[model samples]
Target chain A: MRRSALVVDDSRVVRKAARRMLEGFGFSVREAEDGEQALIACRAEALPNVVLLDWNMPVMDGITFLRAARAEFGADRPPIVLCTTESEFSRIVEALQAGAQEYIMKPFDATILGGKLAQIGLLDAAEVPA
Target chain B: MSGSSPDTFAAIAGLVKARAGIVLTPDKGYMLDTRLAAILRRGNFASLAALAQALRDPRGEPLVRDVVEALTTNESSFFRDGKPFEHVKRILPALHAARPAGARLRIWSAACSTGQEAYSLALLLADQLPALAGRQVDILGTDLSREVVERAREGVFSQFEVQRGLPVQMLVKHFIQEGGKWRIKPALRAMCRFEERNLLGEHRGLGGFDLIFCRNVLIYFDTPTKAKVLAALAAQLAPDGALYLGGAETVLGLTDRLVPLPGERGVYGPAPALARSA
Candidate 1:
């Protein structure tokens, strides 16, 4: 099955970039404007297989959404990868502690994004690592 | 090099592979033609045929050196991949555990063009491993291009170059804003040294390293060349050293002399037998 992804970021540009990269890697991608909406999307009948989250967002930030989704989705919660700028590195450790599986900094290209997805095992090991 | 015969081009391509291990296929003839033209003009040769024949002369070292430099890929960037740097940060504690007390730490950025990646490490080590401030840390960047090696040695980057992959804080902290370029602070530049080298040839007795970043250079080599290069790297790596390949490159099919670290993308360690013997 093609894995599904949810990209939650206040910026449409980042969400679109994430969506394009995720979709190219064989994920059915959905976008949410903020953590609050991402939680709503997670509760849908078909949950995403992974989430490409942004650390900062309006209404609620990525860490809050990660905690809420982990509480509500429990075991069904897909791997969350926090995306942020270089300055927000401290929050990367925080996000990982809060159940995020991995992370990628901003200004990423398709190759870097694919490598991160492969590291999380959301993509095939053989195809993606190369 | 312009309007050269196919035989001359083939001979030049074969010579490049033997000299530098950079395989240029017949499809790359136009690229060779374009790059080699400058060498001819610089040498004031009438045609590439004269240059090619001179390459056969016993005193061809300088001419061959120029050819290799022109063929070497000097393209690189700062923090080429964020993941590997993150992986290094995660592994630092482990690396510390593996090393003895107060031992020097060394990192080799193989084929490091213009020293961006090596200096990037210097900056990272300065920030991430503050405790190592007392310990000796050396970052060596090597390339085949004399022009780029000189640039790396100078430790200067233009505004556009510094903006790529370098954060604002790092830009301000580690660099002096010259007229339109950023010069790496002397302290940072002191941690690094640049040399001209051919990966296929001897390293001139360069010693073992704790971490070797030979990223993105293997894609150009043929299978046999890749295997030879990997084996050579394994020999120079400390028993506990890590070898980093490009995201698109791996040791799985190329050679078993190195094995990929489990759960670590683009990181590998010397094979168990190799590590044990070392």
Candidate 2:
């Protein structure tokens, strides 16, 4: 079974970089520019196994999307990870309270991404091929 | 001098093995290169060869110690493996109940690099074990690296370190932000102490512990060293205590001093035979 991910970030560079990394991890990667598109994509297509969301966006924000998604699809399915440059401790707590499974600071590489995924049970740290 | 020449690698590897009981093979040459680069830069050594030569000198005792410490420093994170922590949480109350009235509980985080494992135990007690209120609980974190022990003593962590394995809610609850870094709250900090102690050396001064966490450390040792360390750990462990090894480590061929605790992963209890004999 192929794992799937929906990356919701306004920056095409970030989405592309994340896609490349996720694809390398054997995940089928999808992209949306903002939270609204990501939510629509979730409803229209099959829900992704995980979501990598950015906080600041044009149409919708990560926290809003997280709340709406949790309410609609249920709280625990398709683990949502907030991948943003928000280093504020309060923001992290807020995202977690709003149902984000994990939080990542931006400027992340494959190692950091893989570690966060492992924390959320998306990947096994020991089994990841070097 | 700094290139990965076989001689330099051999010299450094041999020193580490002799001093720290850590076996380093050719495959870990890259680790030596990466870890030793800082020492070279700090000492202004021209290369790894220069560092290796310096380590050979009788006056290079400090350099040799630093090299060993650098190689032996283990990567750690809070609640590193979720399962072991969960298992500890579930069993702790029962263990507490078994204790005599008002008896203090002590936990050891052996080979505790950067103190995350020790502090994680403190957070567990602070967050979930309200039953332990008014009871004295001590968590001791020991490692071979003086630098890491000092860092652990400070209870300060960079943003990157805190973000690694800690959950957002727990981070908010337990840490205070200080100039873009996080410091473990004073109350929680008081629950644990940090010391520079070698796992391969004497542990007689450290008394019995109700729970011991020596995770991800024995993998670096050879079979003999592992057996010795396990025996030492068993001696310090209380009769009803639990020992947590790394997820990948096992005691099957190592020693008869410990046997796997039933229904738990990566957890062990003193062997029944050893217990009976003792």
Candidate 3:
């Protein structure tokens, strides 16, 4: 089965890039301008397998969405991977505490996104390209 | 493993300096045993004494190369320090503007261990300078160690090696994980070339470079050796070329051939005569 992902970020460029890379890796990716849309997508009947959550976003930032998701969805929520920059170390720690499965630095490449998927067992190691 | 006497250590250090410019102090003698253990065992030398004696022979040239490779430190990573790379990204547009239309850019990563620094430069160029996508941007990675040169050519790195300095995105896009190691894909590897070279020796054919990264490795040399190496590097740089060094390194009180870029610590451009002329 093809996995699905929700890419939550304020930047249209980041969303487009992430969507392309996810599609390349055989994942159906949905973009959200901010955390509000991410929460809505997650609560939808067909929940994504993963969420690539950017720390900074307009209309409910990523952390708020994470906390909200955990509160509403409980442990049945999809694995959330925090997208952050080196300067956001404290935010990353907080995100992890709030139930993020993994984190990757900003300006991320497909290799890193793929690694995160494999890390959380969303992408099988055997399915990875040689 | 047999104990290496003080004389044995000194002799080994001398041989290493003669082949490669790296200076080994008496205090660093302890490091030889740990670093050169593989060489000693592989070469079937009974002790450091035997290796030293063998180095005295004319046929020991190849062995000397191996010894030099063994002694030199190959510790490196992709964008090891973030500051220099940040500077590279910021200065690149200006550097490009200063040159003639469609001018080719040549970058040198001196003592580039396993080619991480050179590859990092390539990645940055690819990401930032979309204008130069079809231009000739050659990144040369040279080291005194043959093993690392070969390894750099192979573009394979372990998980722990990739974990340092490299962001996860770059790791995934530029490399392919094969079992336990990650090998750089052809696209990234194509932007770089690796070679075994002694910085203290002649390198005329390589010609001048537009940017040079001689970071971190120079601290291994003594003051005099550092000056000589800096002079050589200055000679190899294009008139407007920029040089990046480690945070701990400086050209002040060493040589005036290169001057620091204003407000850009650890980055140097050639002195005014050459830089201003260009």
RMSD vs true structure, all candidates: 7.7, 3.0, 12.8
lDDT of 1 by residue, B45-72 (tens): 8877777888888888988988877877
Q: Which tens-of-lDDT digit does each residue in B240-264 have in candidate 2? A: 8999999899988888889999988
Docking class of 1: incorrect
* Per-residue lDDT of B206 in model 2: 94
The list of candidate 2 runs beyond 4 A from truth reads A1-4, A20-27, A46-49, A67-79, A97-99, A109-130, B1-8, B47-49, B273-278
All candidates in order of lDDT, best leading: 2, 3, 1
lDDT computed for candidate 3 = 0.81
The window of 10 residues in a row where model 1 chain B has the poorest summed lDDT is: B160-169
User: For residues B143-169, what per-residue lDDT tens digits would candidate 3 score against the true structure?
Assistant: 988889999999998765675556555
Per-model lDDT: 0.79, 0.87, 0.81
Query: Candidate 2 chain A — worst ten consecutive residues by lDDT sum?
Result: A121-130
Clashing residue pairs found in predicted model 2: B1-B48, B1-B49, B2-B47, B2-B48
Give me the candidate number with maximum TM-score. Answer: 2
Give model 3's TM-score for chain A to 2 decimal places. Answer: 0.91
Please state the interface RMSD for every predicted structure, separated by commas: 8.9, 2.3, 11.0
